[model samples]
Target: MDLPHFSILISDKQYRKLNRNIWSEKPVEAELQIEDKTFDVDLLYRGNHVREFSKKSYHCIFPEITAGIKEIHYNAEFMDKSLMRNKLSLDFFSSIGVLSPTAKHVLLSINEENQGVYLQLESVDRNFLKRRKLPSGPIYYAENDDANFSLHSPIDEDIKDSFDSGYSRKEGSSRDDKTLQELIYKINTLKKTEFERAILDYINIDKYLRWLAGVVCTQNFDGFIHNYALYRNSFTGLFEMIPWDYDATWGQDINGEEMEFDYIPIEGYNTLTARLLDVPTFRKQYAKIFEEILTYHFNKQNLYEKINVMHNTLRPHVLRDPYVAKFIDDFDREPGIILKFIDDRHHYLRNHLQDLR
Candidate 1:
């Protein structure tokens, strides 16, 4: 299957500038070509550690393009041998009712040089909500562990300087930050009774639980405290989640090493999850979500079909990829790895469901 091809043309000066400051967030002027059309764009390196990889990821802002999208991300997925984990994980989240970013595989070319297959991800911003016909709201990215909904730093366990320490505002205003700050404060400072009553007003518990289930089932070790976006729904006045940077999922750790299916606890990590699960009613709701997903969505038989399709589609591409071509053998075995993880993870969670009961 031929994927959509994107060609980027940049001047030598701009290209040199990008390479000189590879770690910088500054975008250089570029022309992006899709099919027969060309549009001016701002292109820059994206991602944290992955930015340093030989096959770097990219962020592109289409100033002149009008496809109801302002920006797009091209993930190198350097650590993920299969290169399908991000899209697969996001698809699973969506299937289980979590509003994760949409992703697709596409071929990229820079200066007419083939850059191989890249996972083109939808940017989780205002446009994300708009496209889904969801209510417009303030969106913030959980950039690190401080986004853990605690007043302490996850790294050092020290009291945080601010309530919104781990988050970067992607959209919204100071008012949105106040709402997030208030939520964090209440989660940490409010007593048991007050918290139980006020928590529902601030967060969409059902959506959070489903997102937790998705994370646990997929086994994203770093997903709990970060790798997500928070959107405050205007109408509901409650915060919801959107997953991001899910390349290290489905039986693999962040380094693409094999991970035990039961590596992540069924309850998930993070203070918000801990506080929510502490409430008996919320725990039961979360347990029910786990049961439902395990019974229907997270099973090997059901997920293997999707896995096979993705694996087969990317197999040919992987063989030809410049960065991942050498790892084709590893890529070939990923379906089995993912499927086994699902089977084992399903068994583990079902047995542990009694804990919630």
Candidate 2:
């Protein structure tokens, strides 16, 4: 099936301004045409280091266009040869009942020039919470730089202060550092036994375990440290982990290197995971969750079928994508790599989880 089409119309002057300093957060006026409808939007170049690349990502705000749906993201997926990595990973998370931003493949054009096929992702903002029926709570994007869940700053530091520590609050009225600072304090100061109890008290353990399983199965090393969101559910009074920026997953590292199946540990990385594994109960639970994922969702056959469908859908557009076609030698071979990674990763995890148990 052909993917949906989205066209952004901007003046030559505005387009030049946007490309002049790609790192700028300056919003340029544009008209977004989706299907048969047109809406006015403010388009801005997004991404930390990706700004330096030719294939640029964008953040669009439909101020006078729509309600509830205020913003959307267009990810370039420049490093990925297959170009289906992010969409597939997010679909996998959703299939396993994880709350993640919705994504779809789209044939994108800027002004009248064909930009290429881009993954259009739903913004993980208040609209996300409303659509998912999740409780309204503070949402913080774990910034790409310092997303490590560690207590590196003083508790007294104003929550409003921008620290290179990499935490950016997206929602919530009171922007004081108290809520997050308290959580960090608890994570750092609490004893092992106390931490086990406190972590369970503050975060949803089952959801976290499932998220950890997804991260391990996908081999998303970057996700462990960054490119995720931690939201405190008002009703449950516990934080839930949300997946983000999965374009580099499925046997590839951040630098586009081919990753080995045995790279990531079954216990996972980060202090929170380390502390959780320290507890006997949490370890057993993790082992069980890992096994369940392999048996039910993370198997080679299920993944291969999904990959085949996406490959078939995207083959035409990928071949025509100017940016991707220039860099990738053989787009046909990309699906095989993902299939092999699934086979190898599943086999490795089966044995690894057994050893852990």
Candidate 3:
């Protein structure tokens, strides 16, 4: 079936509260008839488009939430801080080799009051979709549901199905090694294996293991991968990292430090970072990878700050931006379990730094 480049708005509200997707209301220019609620929506929550608004805020629409996480105020300020952290994380990946979206656009900016953010919306690269397409393929998304409080996930469905023979998760299923080994074998042979066919079976299995690491990291993001073929676009066929979903982000962790230490458990991609930083390995992985990636990005911009580079703020220009600058003050008021998390990871890395060399 042919898809339309645009969608019509059935209804929209100012969200005197929360509106995950940001759009300028002009008029709907699409011909539409609602059928059995096509998963594909011409315009849906978190739909992206390129437009020059008077406000011209840059936002990334995080199509959906995948966790049972409830919203809390004590940690809301972390969203501001975590945006910097996430941008830095993206910047960090770019410093190494992950060439996913550089995010020239602003993801979240503080509103006039700093009470909340005016999320900027940007267009999703269709080509990006091609690169990151799952073997199971993309799921059509819709934002309308009754007050059932149920969440839907296309990516989760694919991840779940990739486990069974077209059948998804069931209570009786045991996802033990035997099951994992079988799943990896099948994935290795897929026409477009998500991992690599060139590698041995263990490496293929490692890829999935890394994805489990991703689950842990993203459990922090509250986003399960949606369209991930390009999770992060690499310069080579050596699949790039993929980061999809937001909104559920920042609200989950009391302390915003999980992304840094997730690899201690090997839940992310097999970059040199994991090999060096994770507890199972040299253990200096987080500090080393953080040092390396942050150095690369900071140097690329000709900005150097030798302080806590992982938490370091590079762009004085960004820092000057009232929106960007709030991360500091807000983070202070924000009660993060992260201070505790940082201590935990620091304790681990401190214990293992010698092994990293």
| TM agreement with the true structure for every prediction | 0.98, 0.93, 0.38
Clashes of each: 0, 0, 16
Please write out the lDDT profile of model 2 over residues 148-209, one tens digit for every residue.
66644224433433332567789875553467767766776789878877787787898898
2 against 3, candidate with superior lDDT:
2
Q: For residues 270-357, what per-residue lDDT tens digits would candidate 1 score against the true structure?
A: 8888888999899999999989999889899998889899888888877778888988888888888888888988899999999888
Instruction: Give the worst 10-residue stretch by lDDT in candidate 1.
Output: 62-71
lDDT of 3 by residue, 127-231 (tens): 334444523222122121110111222334222223223222211124332343353344334343333333333222233333333333323333222322222
Off by over 4 Å in 2: 64-67, 153-164, 326-329
Residue 243's lDDT in candidate 3 = 41
Order of the predicted models by TM-score, top scorer first: 1, 2, 3
Instruction: In angstroms, give how far residue 98 of model 2 lies from its true place.
Output: 1.7
Error of 1 at 136 (Å): 1.1
**Cα lDDT listed for each candidate:** 0.89, 0.82, 0.31
Worst 10 residues of 3 by lDDT: 66-75
Question: Which 10-residue window of candidate 2 scores lowest in summed lDDT?
Answer: 153-162
